[model samples]
Target chain A: MKIAVCVKQVPDTWAQKRLDPDDKTLDRESVDGVINELDEYAIEEALQLGEATSGEVVVITMGPDKASETVRKALAMGADSAIHVCDAALHGSDALATSLVLAKVIGDRGFDLAIFGSESTDARMSVIPAMVAERLGQAQLTFAGKVDVEGSTVKIRRIAEHGYDEVTASLPAVISVVEKINEPRYPSFKGIMAAKKKPVERLTLAEVGVPADQVGLAAVASAVESFESAPPRAAGTVVTDEGDGGVKIAEYLSSQKFI
Target chain B: MAEILVLADHSGGEVKKVTLELLTLARSLGEPSAVVVGAGAGSTVDALAEYGARRVYVAEDAELDRHPVAPAAEVLVQLVGPHSPAAVLIASTADGKEIAARLAVRIDSGLITDAVQVDADLTATQSIFGGSVIVKSRVTRGTPVITVRPNSTAPEAAAGPCEREDLSISLSDGASRAVITNRVEEKHDARPELAEAAVVVSGGRGVGGADGFKVIEALADALGGAVGASRAATDAGWYPHQYQVGQTGKTVSPQLYVAAGISGAIQHRAGMQTSKNIVVINKDPEAPIFEVADFGVVGDLFSVVPQLTEEVVKRK
Candidate 1:
């Protein structure tokens, strides 16, 4: 059971994220970066599965040079090795190009299972995992709240709008886990020290068989046209309770036609 | 006019509200074609035509959904190859995004998800950065695939020449690998669907416990709306996880959103800030939710919610 957990370095979930006005791309350098919140669940799930099956857990990431920090963090949390797909041309890439690179790397490795967080906080698109699965022509078991593995087959409880569905697929599949799947473990000091000695392979787009012509903002299918801050909400009316607060609210609702 | 494919979401032989809303949006772009992939084709025709769908295509295959999303993607891909519609419009649900994603890859098109508004020329406006920033995007390659956020548009009814076509299903072996073994749908309730509800009343940590949600439900029932909860309440088991309204939960942009005892965390605000009207009821006057509310009352939710519910019921 060789498991690959894909992690991304994103700005702190609580930070003020912004897009650069000149280029309309996410301003990654303006804020402190950390491993995407939900990816920790993917890492933890991979580590637990690896431990249970006595298999190897490898971490993978794609971004600027700073992204290796996320890979190292995943390794510190018990992943055995790491791969960082870093290239200058990878900047301003959209989900399509990102999935292509991820699929190329994962396809080359022939891992039994590839895992991802449901979505990145910044983008919040939740399309990359499915896109990667399509690019590889592999089964996508996404939004999994629970996962079970047996004899080259994987089963999961896929969360849906109404409830959940029990889904099963063959091995060498792509899986995206929701946040409720498991709690991620923090790295221990000894584990962090061991990670420093672990192997981290760095590759460029060419090495992954992704041509420069097929990536970045220029190659993107959907191009950002214009952007502005959302219009400020209207002024609000605030009042402290004076025994008739509910009546006042009812009147306000009536006036607004909400009642 | 160029043809535009609109994927209609159906359940229990009825088309979903978001699909009708998508049809309204599509009418302004080009000729609207509704594609029903599963069981609801026979039952959803009138509703689809009522919302301005000029043509309806049904791929009536039980096996399409018996497998996971891949077969649906294959179906859409087959449709796109022949018609080459101006654009593809789909709902931004979890399943819809996955199906659109696979079709985008197979057709070599640019795909945009969760768009708040799409223009006549296929440019889409998206609210991002936790709903603080608005970005407009355009597809530059292949047939554009755009997924519209639910409740982003007001569904309007318009008569159209309703024509129906049944598609031939041909799914490859690889597309049917992931099989759905069992399904457990939540029991249907009388309240309106949260995402589609025009009014939503949500409770938070200050609700105290699961028992405290009664007042919240009372207000929702009085207004003929849906019930929601902040992540704190859901995480604490005070409410069902499905009813949680936040970034990681469900994003709802109702016409009127009432937050009771919820401190406006960034996650909670991101989900419902786009709502047209917001009202907050909490004991603490300084709660952050007051900043975004159109009407804020500083009072205990237990007292405020019941009184408000009574007043609304009386007016009706």
Candidate 2:
């Protein structure tokens, strides 16, 4: 099985991330960047499946220069090789453009399975994999808590609103896994050293067949008009437990007409 | 008036609250048409009509429900071909977002998900950075595709002549590739869904272990609300991941949120800071959850939860 996993470099989850005032894009330079926490699971899943089938696990990422760090991490985690799609014209690309570029890259590679984390943290839209699948004209089995691949068939226990549905799709499908799938392994010293020697192929829009005009904010469909900090919530009454704390809460609820 | 298509999410023939909320939001933009797709699509017209659906387009087909989201996206794409609606609105569930995503790609449109509000001009206001920063955005390309969060709009009743239209669609091989093998419905007895609940009671690390969640459940049950868990508690194996409320889990905007034993991390706050009223109870007085809480109680959840449950039950 030829497995491909898409990893994204996002600002540290713990960092106070902000949008650049000039472009309304993420302020990637101000904060430390790390592999999106969930994408680690995606790479891990691909690595495990790759090892099982004696296949190659190629990590795919599309971002700025700093995003290569994320690709290196995936490589360090035992991925065979990495592809970094980087270009200045890629800035401010919405989910559509980003997926368009990713689909083009994956289309050229011709992988049997393309995997992604369920959603990116900053955007949290959780729509890229579906968009990519739609663009690729393939089946999308996304939001999977568990994924199992057979010969020419893939099955997943997709997390849903009520419970989980066991979904099956043919090969050459798009699969996005949730965090519950598996615990990602940390890179070993040997693996980290080996990752430094692994091949990193860098590509641009021209190589992917997507035009510069079709991507980035200038050609995008959606635009963020303006933004501001939400007003701070006023501090409410704080009461120490005086043996009547529960009673006091009941009184407050009653006053608020909750009970 | 231009049509505004609203995908009515349903299960077992009953329409979900978020669809009504979407209908209400779509009315602000243009004529609201509710698209119900499934074998049981006809059963939800009354409820959709009650919430101001001018027309309910029912597409009855097993293939649409058998697949994940591709079939539904195809249905919407077919509907949009002739209607050319002003915009498309869907409930921002996991599947809903994916449907909107694929639809945006097929239609060459801009997509926005999890919007808290929508203006008349098709602009959407979203709570970002864990509900701390507010951003206003709009679609600039082709047709705008947007998803609305549950409870974001107060559903108002506007009795409409709910005209029924049957849509015939032949699924392409692209939309029919994925097949659902099995479905295991969630087993929560009589408890409301966490996202749709008006009141939510959540537990955190202070709940101790899996058994400690019983107290949390009791409180939620007493108040006739849903049970939620902080990421710490869920990660610690006290609860399931689906019940986890945080940036990585389900985002809930409820009328009232009672958080017990949680130390409000930015992640947890991001999922629920938009809640109208918050009450936090913790042994630690300095837990960050108190910063945004409407009421804070400095006490152990073990004691406070039971007592609160009893008080609520007695009041009822």
| Among all candidates shown, the one with the greatest TM-score | 2
Q: Candidate 1, after superposition: displacement of residue A175 in Å?
A: 0.8
Q: What C-alpha lDDT do the candidate models reach, one value each?
A: 0.90, 0.90
Tens digits of per-residue lDDT, candidate 2, B1-316, equal: 8899999998868888788889888888899999999889989999999998999999988878889898889999999888899999998888899999989998999999999999999889999988878999999888899998888988887887889999888988878888998989984958877887888999999889999999999888888889999999988888988898997888999888999999999889989999988999999999999999898899988877788888998998
Question: lDDT of model 2 at residue B239?
Answer: 92
lDDT of 2 by residue, A139-232 (tens): 8999989988888899999987678999998899999998878989999999999999999999988988898999997888899999998999
- Cα deviation of B118, candidate 2, in Å: 0.5
- Count of clashing residue pairs in every prediction: 0, 2
Best by DockQ: 2
lDDT of 2 at B219: 86
Ten-residue segment with the worst summed lDDT in candidate 2 chain A?
Answer: A242-251
User: What is the per-candidate TM-score for chain B?
Assistant: 0.96, 0.97
